[model samples]
Target: MLTNKGTLIPIGGNEDKGIEDNEQYTLEFIDDGILFHVVREAGGTDANIVVIPTASSIPVEVGENYLEAFSTLGCKNVTVLDIRSKEDSEKQASINLIKAANCIMFSGGDQSKITNKIGGTEIHDIIKYRYKNEKGFVVAGTSAGAMMMSQEMIAGGSATESFIKGAVKMYKGLGLVPGLIIDTHFIKRGRFGRISEAVAQFPQLIGIGLAEDTGMIIKNKRCRVIGSGMVIIFDGRRLKHNRHKILTEGTPMSLTGMRTHILSNSDSFHIEKKKVKILPIEAPFI
Candidate 1:
């Protein structure tokens, strides 16, 4: 129920940065890509955008990557907040950058690092405050950054575990969106079973599995899919039979009445309503 006024863009891993390893193609693919949408939603290229690469092990390289990507999108006012430790989150410099920014973009690496370093910090509080109260404030993240948006964060899991019990590991997140449990790299990484167990654990929350290069723009409890891949939604609230609680760890589990939705770019989903809204605004949403 912690729906906010600002926008939340949680992308699956491997988003188009518009750059290659050998400096091949730049700005050619990312024109209408995820970063373009991020810039557009953050009030365009002039918006004060701050990229936090705290989750990344190589913060400098990741930070520079975002700088170039945003630069290619015509974003003139982008800054990288290289937060490495918990102490860095409390610094006046970091707080100032967060306070002045219209959008905060989190880079992917380790989701736990974001919560460990910045969770409950001053800037974290400020972001939640602005996101809850402000209309245009944007909080966007990719991969691990995407997973940290949910209150119930997926820390780590065994992809090889299949649909077995205890395959997914979860932890506390930023609590920006309490209604969702987000997972990144769904199709490529084969995270269907991982998120399925996660939904069985917290049946009240909706499970969102975002594929590579895909993302969702969430506002006012409504989510619209973006990017090139798919977004798998698992609704477990109407579950009839759940064998997760009784099953032992590592055992295969069965869950009945777990509703699923496979949505692509331009498709829409109303979170509270649990209904899909396809393209064409003139037609019936449900």
Candidate 2:
């Protein structure tokens, strides 16, 4: 049982961008207006936010992007931690920044890079400790960052090839949250088959698919959907299937009795109870 009192924001890739008069990005991605939400959750504008761009190939560029975004959102003490190697992750200065941060944001990129470079380092340990012990600490990540928030993560696989047994590679992640697997770029990328197969493989874990521009805000036992798109839940707890016929390489596996739920913005889901509360729709009176 994981009991982290802090908040986790896992966003799908390619969030909507706010445009300026000069046809440039306003630095606000219309991630259901989540940048503001993050500010609020991290104890308002004076919050100390450290952005980690380790997952990105172009760390400097990605780091700048977040620095600008948070700055535009009026967050005063936002800084980017340019961690390239395990040594950088272990630095006392890096660890100090994490310890002082009200929020830690992981930028989108290759999740393996994040786990390899930062995992088990002093920075990672401090993050885990603060997230569990601090009341309002926040951990936010997008795309690959979002994918690595669980105990088990999708390393790589195309949706078309995922039906084949052992096609998708699963890897150990940050383990900030347990018993869950998160997949980003869900609807736009057509990742249903990929996430479905993941659930079939590990029926005990819940499979969550986050569509682009959408995300989930998870606390201890509940998650609230945020953004314009939807959150797909593939529950395999009641699943029934025959695996003997499909264990051979290249053969497509079959699964049955898996339950699924689609949640839109403002909807809430109870993690422990596996329950969903849909927000009431608004309509004009006749």
Candidate 2 is scored at a TM of 0.92
lDDT, model 2, position 237:
93
Lowest summed lDDT over 10 consecutive residues: which window, candidate 1?
21-30
lDDT of 1 by residue, 135-216 (tens): 9999999889999999999999988786988888899999899889999989988988999999999999999999987899
Residues 106-213 of candidate 2 have per-residue lDDT tens digits of: 888899999999888888888888888888999999888888888888988878785787777788899887778999989988898888877877888899999977
lDDT of 1 at 104: 96
Report model 1's TM-score to 2 decimal places: 0.92
In model 2, the worst 10-residue window by lDDT is 19-28
Candidate 1, residue 14: lDDT: 67
Candidate 2: which stretches are off by over 4 Å? 16-31, 242-246, 283-286
